[model samples]
Target: MLDRPTFTISNVRSGDVVSYPLVLFDGQLHGASAATSVTVSRIGADHPRLRAHTYTAPSQAWPVALDTGVFKALAFLVPGENVIEFRAGAEPVAAIHRLVVHYLNAPWDYCVRAVYVVPADDPVGGFQAPPHERCDIDSAVHRLALAMRLLQSALAELMHRHGLGRYTFCLEEPAQARACPSEGGYEEVLVAYGVPVHVHRFKHSRAALQALSGDELYGRVGQALSGAPDRESRIDVALMSFTRKDAHTGMLYGHTALGGGRLALFGSGSMFSWPENLEQVPRRFTDRTAVDGRRFLDDSAGRGEYWALASTSMGAVLHELGHCLSLPHPHNGGGIMARGFDYLYRLFGVAEPQPGAEMQAPDEPRLDRSAATRLRFHSYLIRAGSEPHPATLYPPHPPPAPDGAVSVPVPSPSPTPTPPRPRLYVATNGLPARARAHHEAHSAPRRPSITWQSEGVVRVSAPNGLGHIGYYLNGDVAAHEEFFQASAPVHLLDIPWREVCRQCGNPPAGAKIRISCVDHAGQIEEAFERQVGDRP
Candidate 1:
């Protein structure tokens, strides 16, 4: 294919010939090879009747020109975002290539790599619910299809925003080609209404889908998209289905872009397994679970990448799409992509683009315009033959924690038992760091206690009703299952060291040490320094 393939379209202004390179993908190549025959027809949303065109393979086999008749017929097809389904006759699998068909636009192409279908069950797909007596497989399939379409559309939008102008969808025409139960499977039913079908052994699996590493998925999709033999003969988007909810050991995973940059759809078992109308699978993690101590990351591990956490809604999918397109949370974006459901909803009532709206680069890894454009393409593909009202926009949310009074705790000294030491020393005054003081307030509770051994190994008892206790001198907070102190007058050494110290070096005559203790709330008490041995 030429770096630019010129296609002339009429029914518009001058210079209708626009050239955007077609992504020659393997699926298209395979589709063309197997297609007994193909016919290109212009069925515009606003245009008149349908017109047919011819596309033939070349003799020299270098680069083939679309038939002149086909070119003329294509010329009549009006521009500005169109869905062109490449019709297949008796082909085992049907394919539809949806090209945005822009007139004289810049070079553009979009690609959707792997897709997700999060279920209403375990988001991770580990636990299986007790099988219900009545199962609604059709409903499950519908949800699966809905999720797939959302993923496809979001990815296409990402690609389109990145400047890709073409989109496609491929699915195996079921052999029986039976009509899906009245309500669900409308798209598939209409497309493959009377066509023969092709069957695949396995469809989608949540746990196994992430088997493909990020690099593998990226490289393979890029390669297939850049180099396929048949440029315009086959469908662009490739539809893959999964029978099981796709998952791995972790929350994240990726898959390869098969058949040349064609998008992959992973319809998991949950699609055919979960009850319809279910949203937000409730999950709780204990301290021992993997989710415990786990922190969600702000960035993806690579360039041209994004991340998502699934909720059983289109909004959640949109949020993920934002990530996939390299768009940050709208809260951070100000308003460009923010929504109430996202983390930023509790604050201001208006949705505003983040502080640096014009700036594109994020310190963390993200998708570029190229990826976003591709996502737009997927979005177009998913919304094909249908219209969904645009999502409602919301405002920025405030932080979860509030700014308020700092809470503090009182301390109690515990007893200590120890052997007598030859040396007895006393230090007077001290001041604690702000961090240490704050930490004590939160860590210690109302009934706090401290334990430490005396230098003489003497036993010291502590006040029974003391509220909190603090460790002396050390900046680190201390907690133990059992107390070590026997008792305490709260002074170091049994000697009248204060008078002795005053007599000796006159050691400033009145210095004091501060300590931290626990309180009733299991938090630490604040530190207080005192003066010793004045005239009193």
Candidate 2:
């Protein structure tokens, strides 16, 4: 209100609580021109709690990218309290003020570990570095650390956008001999300024890695990164950079997969363009420079290859992580489980260098509603104290009227590992769309314990307290997916035809959709396959 270049932080106000270490702050300035420079620096900050830990380092401020008056600033905050200052224009220019955002590290135990998988044959830790950068372990560590931080912030933002608070998976801090600062016996961490990455040299050489198939690749990562698989505590992101370019032919073998349980592998081909430091984050997003076609996977959207690699590498890892968490619902709807992660930069920056027709100004990537339910109730993501007690039993959900929900009576929640499996019932009312559940007699024998339900019109309910509804259609590909939360208003998770078509796009002329509903306790009973098009 007072100066020519009015600097204001819109996303987060002064004294608001924030969780992630590296945060993007978006704001506006009316008076300043497009080229006006906006620099951000911290005046003074302090971390009262966990003060003794050596990793609780100070925060750093970075320059803001101001485009046509609207600007985006990046800042790093310590655990307890962080004060960030933003100044618009040059030294003597108008509107330079300081703002503060409280930093409260989320209280979570299960952590996401950032690990760089080094091939035994290579000793120097050679990896493709950003242009004119070093290809060493230190550089790999910085690149991986930045990617992990971006992933952390992106999840937090997406969950918040879904009306759920800033809930996200925890990232492991530096190794510490001392116990966590939590009051109870739980995981307590402080996300400081720097990215802490672990370099694990695989006993197997590059030849072994190249020879391994997808399953073999996942198995290797599990054996190396995930120790004592039973009730594992940490989820590891195993990143590798194994690329070779020669005269005749080139080979880039990225043994990437969404390994079950605790590990996910990622290839860092575009990491050279990734920000090693906090300041370069803005510049990295808008980098339109083309990438070596033979060396890396071309993930660049309408923007340049550098940015596409950043978005794809990071988002692709997250997608795999989602599968690792047992949320492998079919890639339907424009969600993280789908291909929505290409515009990951939109979550942080207010603008991109060159925008395509589909690329909007402020649209960001996110997890769909069904995926949200899965993440919220996932065994790993559940907070230490917030876990459901086996002894406690919830009441039975009211069954649907004579139309959709059929005669099968629902059961109450139980503590047993394998409780009574839920049954599938369909409504053939044909009000909206008709998907009739075949009577056991007419139901064709497909596979053992498999039946075909006329999809697009049906009532499939998972009465179990915690449930997930999945559809694997067109052979291996997934069509529509759904999940029910433990705190859902009604346990009868209805799958209407109208909603099904909306959630799952049009299937081919002839495709079989295998629908499965599994309870959290590993009980699977309510399931069948649906045949689309004229019955063959």
Best model per TM-score:
2
Clashes of 2: 2
User: C-alpha displacement of 94 in model 1, angstroms?
Assistant: 47
lDDT of 2 by residue, 349-449 (tens): 65665666536533357787666645644434421111122111111232444644323222222111123343232121111111222433113331113
lDDT of each: 0.26, 0.55
Worst 10 residues of 2 by lDDT: 426-435
User: In lDDT terms, how accurate is model 2?
Assistant: 0.55
The parts of candidate 1 lying over 4 Å away from their true place are: 1-136, 148-200, 203-260, 263-308, 311-367, 372-536
RMSD of each: 29.4, 12.0
Model 1 Cα shift for residue 492 (angstroms): 86
TM-score of each: 0.23, 0.68
The top-ranked prediction according to lDDT is 2
